[model samples]
Target: MVKAETVDKAYEIAKERYAEVGVDTEAAMKRLETVPLSLHCWQGDDIHGFLNPEQELTGGIAVTGDYPGVARTPDELTSDLHEALSLIPGKHRVALHMIYAVAKDGKKKDFNDIKPEDFDYWIDWAKKEGIGLDNNGTFFSHPNVKDNMTVASPDKNIRDYWIQHGKLTREVSNYIGEQLGQTCYNNFWVPDGFKDNPIDKLTPRERMLASLDEIEAKDYPEANEQDSFEGKLFGAPGIESFTVGSHEFYQYYAITRQKLWTIDAGHFHPTEDVSDKFASYFPFTKKDLFMHVSRPVRWDSDHTVIVDDALLRITRSLVRDNLLDRTHIGLDFFDATINRVAAWVVGARATQKSLLQAMLAPIDQLKQSEYNADFTTRLIETEELKSMPFGAVWDKFCQDHNVPVGFDWMDNIHQYEKDVQFKRN
Candidate 1:
């Protein structure tokens, strides 16, 4: 581990370098503290939620590893989350799926009949942790998923059941937000599609639109509850041909309905840059944006995020456009091939690092160069900025936040695995 004195000395020198380019490192770090990432809870248990431990993961979703020590209960998942959160800098929120709800009475409840009280255990835990919560309605991996569709299903019984599930999720999300005193973003993403090219594609989308309209008809306090919709390019084999909620579909829906729209990094085509989409939407929408940051390798593999070019571009776009305040950032990847807790720490920290790098950039200077048509200076300065002492500033940020600097946090993960995770037989 690097000594505190060395970290401080390096930060001082790095701070001077950044100042030369008209950037305030201190202000950047301070701004970073205000941005809270909503870490997804599905990573803790591979999306095998507590409601149905034996239920096969259907609806075109699949987790590819058999890593041991997966959290089998709500308690274990939260404990693991606590450990992961300690190593990450700044305050963050936990995003939970409705399927993870706990019953204090030890009785199973029907999906449509679920109440806000069912999530009291999680709300109570969040109170103690002093962090806010976010929510998503579990539309997949349930018995009601007929013909691989939920709200868009032709069966009225199945469609109504899922629509009611969506409505109740809004209530539960509102309760969570009220308790935690933060706006809970209730995101909707359904696995409703067909494997082959359907001749009646128009019918499913029409049904989906009507179902969503009914779900959003009930009013909730805007201060506590906000609804968002997520779209996908494709999914696992059976549902790869046609996704009911395509990007165009949700983009239009969110715009017309005045709801937040979510853009998952891994939900688009492999070559499509999600970074560019933000600016395109800002020109028209007045609502806050929601994002699911994930690393997709070749496909939507949901790999553990690393500080790569794609990740950097996404963060840079947000920072350059000055849209951090209006954006809700969240992680949405589950990699069961390695230690789950470690996966959380790695992905979250990678995102934070990317954001810090973006903030440290002299965007004003870069913009001025562009306006003056000084392409030469813009190119040279950007290239040189890459070699600046970014690592030092990052290490300093970690130290200031009381988190482990550099690779030292790995020691905690290893020890936790031996003492806490490995012993989970």
Candidate 2:
């Protein structure tokens, strides 16, 4: 382990270098501490929530590997989450799907039948951890997702069942925010589309909009519940031809309804990116925007995030546009192949590292150069900024927060696997 004084010495040297370029390392670290990345709970258990363990995971989602020690109950998931959070710097929130709701008597309950009390334990757990909560209505992997249709189902009964579930989920989200004293970002996404070319794509989309309207009709207090919509380009094998909730559809819907629009990293095509949409949607967002930061390999594989160019660009855009506070960032990838806690720490740290790097950049200088019409200097400085001592600043940030710096976290993960996870089998 690197000593505190050594980390401080590295920070002081890096701090002087950054100061010369008009960036304050200390202020950047302080800013990063306030940004809470919502950690998705599905990663700990590979999205196999404690809802109905007997049901098979379907509806375009699958956990690739059969890695052992997957959390089987709410308590086990909570324990794993606690271990992961300890390794990640700064306070963070947890993102929960409706399926994670725990019944008081440990009985299985259907979506529509679920209540806020089902999530009482989560709220209590969040309180103890001193973190906030975000929520999502699970719209896939259920019987009601008949023929891969959820909110956009042509059948009235199937549509109504999902709508009731959505309404109930919103209520639970509101309750969570009310209990935690922070606005919970309640997101809605559906896997409604056809495998082959559809004769009428318009009808399904229209149905989905109506179903969502009905779900949102049950107005909850804005202070507690802030709702948003997510759109995907495609889904599992059969649903590639048409995903009912495409990006354009939800972008228009969110604009019209004046709600936050969620941009999931894995929801877009590999060539396309949401980094450019920051300025476009920043004006339309009412209160705050939301993002599901997942690493997409070719498609929505939900790979653990690394400090790649795409992620750096996203964070840079947010920092350059001054939208960090206006955006609610959350991690949303699940890789069952590796140690789940290590996956969380890796992705969460990568996210924090990217944010810190962006913050430490001399964006003001770059902007000033651009405004002066010195395009050559702007290009040169931007390229040169890449090699700056951002790692030193990141090390200091982790040191200040008392979390492991760099690969030092791997030691803790190895110990955890032997002491906790290996015994799960």
Candidate 3:
């Protein structure tokens, strides 16, 4: 256990070091509080939403490992989420898929038939927890998906079914936002693609656009609900050839339609630096951006995030360019190999740590050095900042937030597993 006094002393020393570089530790911590990460609900249950837990996870989504104690009900999922949130510093929103809706009064609803009332339980829970909610339309793992398509399917019936689901999802999202007094981001992503190189790729994309247009026809106030479109590079086995909604597709769609564009870190090529794309979009994007932070190994593996170089670059890009206000950060990884609650705590804290490190950087000095063409100073100072007492600042931040400092949180997770998760079976 790390003593609070030791944490305070280390923070004081770290504060003075950062002061030498003209950085305000207090202000950095304060700024971090304003940016909240939207934690994905699917991670708690491995994407097996309550609507149909027996359904196979389709649309190129796959969660490996037989880690016991996965949440099997809405209550279990939320309870696990509460446990995860307790360990993570700062208030954050929970992102829900339409499939997670809780039925009421012995009533059940499918994706297309579910109403906002179906999500009342989640809304009430969020209200009590003082957190916000985000939502997504479930486009896969349902009977309507034909030939690996939903909205872009050649079958109008299949397309219309999903279109209705999309519309209802937006309604539910808007309701949740209004109920919670926070803006709900409703994101749309489909697994419409072909296994073999389709001779007619343009037609599927055209159909997808029309379907999305129909879904967006009924608009809600941006204050209550904002819509986003997520694209992909490739998908599961059958979707390897052609993804109808590629990054290019959504980029144009989002800009032209004035909707938010989602950029999942794993949805791009392994070599691509998603951080670099922010500057490219910030100039012309009239609306805010949404990001799904995940670590992809070789392909879209959705590995648990650590405080690695890619994450650092991403958080640094946002901080250095002052784009935190324009971007909504969210987690998108699901790893069933470890303790589920521990995975959430680790990923969330890693993200928080990266953001803190970025906040602690001497960004002003680095920018001035760049503006003056002092490459030597710019390079050296960036490297020097890496060696500074960043862990102390992070520990202080954790202390201030009343979350565990350092690895002490792991002990709590083990106890929870023994008392709560392990008893699930």
> TM-score for all predictions?
0.98, 0.98, 0.98
Q: 244-337 in candidate 3: lDDT tens per residue?
A: 9999899889999999999999899888998998999878778989988899998889998889999999999999999999999999999999
Highest-scoring model, lDDT: 1
Judging by lDDT, tell me the better candidate of 2 and 3: 3
**How high is the CA lDDT of each candidate model?**
0.92, 0.89, 0.91
What is the Cα-based lDDT of residue 248 in candidate 2? 87
The total number of steric clashes, by the backbone 3 Å criterion, in model 2 comes to 1
For residues 220-264, could you state the per-residue lDDT of candidate 2 as single tens digits?
Answer: 888899998889999876699999999989888888888888999
Candidate 1 vs candidate 2, lDDT winner: 1
